[model samples]
Target: MAIRDAGDQPAAGIYGLSIETEPMEAKLAKALPSGEGWQYEPKWDGFRCIAFRSDSSVDLRAKSGKPLGRYFPEVVALLADLPTPNFVIDGELVIEVEGKLSFDALQMRLHPAESRVRKLSRETPSRFIAFDMLVDTDGMPILDKELAYRRARLEDFRERIEADPAYLTVSPATKNLREADAWLSRSGGDTDGVVCKRIDEPYRPGERAMMKVKRLRTADCVVGGFRYERDSELVGSLLLGLYNDDGLLDHVGFTSAIADIEKPELTARLESLKGGPGFTGKAPGGPSRWTTDRSSDWKPLRPELVVEVKFDQITGCRFRHGTKLLRWRPDKKPSQCDFRQIGL
Candidate 1:
């Protein structure tokens, strides 16, 4: 099953020894694309990397087009030692902590200090989860090949060159929609979501040609506060809050999807309810220098308004990103928006 190294050097240009191929991307979708000709894979929650190896060169590039080999020296060594040469692979750079994938540990590898990077690599070595094959050992660029054939070649390559489990892993793919849904339900922690691609689609670099479905769950939260647009009197974002175990209202996240036409009215309404309690449990403290202009103009509110919003992921008792306002829930009381709804 080994792909023969037709030449000592990689193919000339982007997929060559000096690999610089842009990784393919996926589009966010509310639901998985249905019907036939779709292959699903886990959307790994780590840095996206494209790995390449030639006769004497092994390079890893982050999705940001930055060099990753300096930070992931262990991965570089593993790729260098592999028997198969002149190949490029698209994958995620992940590190496991106590049998669970740790995205934080992977992020810590990006330090400028070489010593720090080396220490972390030794403490929690990174693993490349190969999801797709871009170039073969024969130094042939297969970016134009259909995914069905590319997957077959990748599987074949895996069979021939069994990578070390400690430093590398082959990401699993399936055609079953049920399995993908199961993965989506389990999205959080190590898994972020599920990625779906057309079976016959060729890799489209730097484009959202593939589909990704994330877990979008709804929550009823209290509009504990609101932020004004940097230069306008309109509402920019609504600070959401929920009661903790001790019955203290904690700011969980924010929603900023208020329509332009409704902003003036909503702003006036929110202004009238100002200065009761922004967040009792944990307030939006003084802004850091890095705070965005919009986030820096927040105002404490009465915490009397209740709103329903949709969120994808939560971490450290806070929403990972800004939520989308679904509707105002006057029927649901703010006290009812408790921490019990979310499983920590």
Candidate 2:
């Protein structure tokens, strides 16, 4: 395999990476297709990092080709202490809080201040879960090698060099269909879903060659509120909510899948139901630094309308992303829309 630079030019000299290497990518699939050629692993919900440890240095590279060494110093230190003289391993940086994987803690490590990063590194710390090997112990490039070979080498390295399983360990893999389905079924909080790869397929760097099947489930949500377009009365997005155990409607997420023609009718219907106490449980608007300008500008509505939406995952008691609006569930009652569907 001919490795190329960012400019698409052929890489110079040896494959000795000096803080540079494009990581292989994966494609998203709705379902994991069955076959004997498939290898499945849990899709960890954390920063994807590719570690390069040389004789003199060790570097952690993110999926977007960004440097992560400054943020995750503890991981760098662990990589430096590895028994291997030099090698490249692909893995994820995860921070666990209270026995559960915390993505928020991983995000907090991206502090600009070195002091803050250092503090968090000592306080919470991070772990590296190796999944693939792009460079072998002999310092030979293995981009042309198949997934089965790379996976075996990666596992061997973990068993040999990664003596301490606390900070560095190889992710578990399975080829059994029943076990793969179990991973997908229980994917949340820590594990995002299951990633299936063809054992015979070579790692295609910067390409979506591997397939990923995330946790996708549908929920009937109460349309408790909505946000109007800046200049028009049309609906920008439908605010979604689910009743908590205390009978309080909590704003989980929203969907902007309204058709242009149906907007007028939807807007009118929503306008009629405009009222207070839309979200009794965890209402929107807070000291969140990551909010949009319209985050505080949602129009509250009567908890009467219900919608069926498909969502991938829920994190921090909210939808990880905007749920896809499936249809207006007129047959479903808003009272029926509860967190029970998500088993929350």
Candidate 3:
């Protein structure tokens, strides 16, 4: 894919607006923002997509302004078939498997081969959950309009196109804080958390004008291994693992939120039990695009120690990001730390 600079002139699409228009961003908040003008919606855990339909041509752009048309051909075709020929909609591109959203299936669409992408699209078709509209069906840009007016325009646009909830659907939003809290409490398998936006505020492009709170959960995991600091011998991160149904421990994730004052004693304590195989099922991998040279240089442990970790999302049986070290789970046994705790 060709890289486009942020300052470059965006290519024009429907309603004379660029298909690669910068998406509005959200600031991560510890708690949901409460106010009179706040509108809450379920934060879908999928690819942030800005879809544009210009006559027969449809373009799907990622939040980073990268072209996603090749990855999701079914979604492109769905938009092209809409009754409204010219429009720009902001939403998420999600894939569902077994009646639940599977982010791993959505990531599989990023294949380089077109044949493989087409095969996966057939096996696991994706859905476009519409949330916002930048261009109306009348081919007019509504960037300066308030979100309350824009949402009405989006609903009318969806009605004109007669979007099917199975493929193309409008996302539900509410103004009540109680309903928003309920959505956050039931967040899992489908929604990630809750996104609160100002109903009276105009569209602010490429700005953190919205607030988002992610649903966090805790899990007990076995201390499978430990990685040392870049140059020092002190412990840096603790590799976490959980036992599978087959009785083999798999590397789930790691936590590096250790306090500096405890590194000396912790390093010494970890070094004493570093001889056995750490994770019997899946182990840490070598250096990759997201890893350092010392990522694979980890010392295996006896899997006797257990630790509690706080995490947000898990994809393909592994934590999506580095976990937060909560506390030592000395009261919890290594065998008690299994995938069932995470609803595997």
Candidate 2 per-residue lDDT over residues 75-145, each given as its tens digit: 77777776776788888888989999987788788678989989999999899998999888888888789
Off by over 4 Å in 3: 1-10, 217-344
Better of 1 and 2 by lDDT: 1
lDDT of 1: 0.78
After superposing candidate 2, which stretches have Cα over 4 Å from the reference? 1-14, 217-344
Q: Report the Cα lDDT for candidate 3.
A: 0.82
Q: What's the CA error at residue 233 for candidate 3, in Å?
A: 16
Model 1 stretches with alpha carbons more than 4 Å out:
1-18, 217-344
lDDT of 1 by residue, 194-234 (tens): 98999898888866578777675667788988888777878
Worst 10 residues of 1 by lDDT: 1-10
TM-score, every prediction: 0.63, 0.63, 0.64
After TM-score superposition, what is the CA distance of residue 23 in candidate 2 from its true location, in Å? 2.0
- lDDT digits (tens) for residues 124-187 of candidate 3: 9999998998988888899889999999999988777776789999999999999999999999
Q: Identify the leading candidate in terms of lDDT.
A: 3
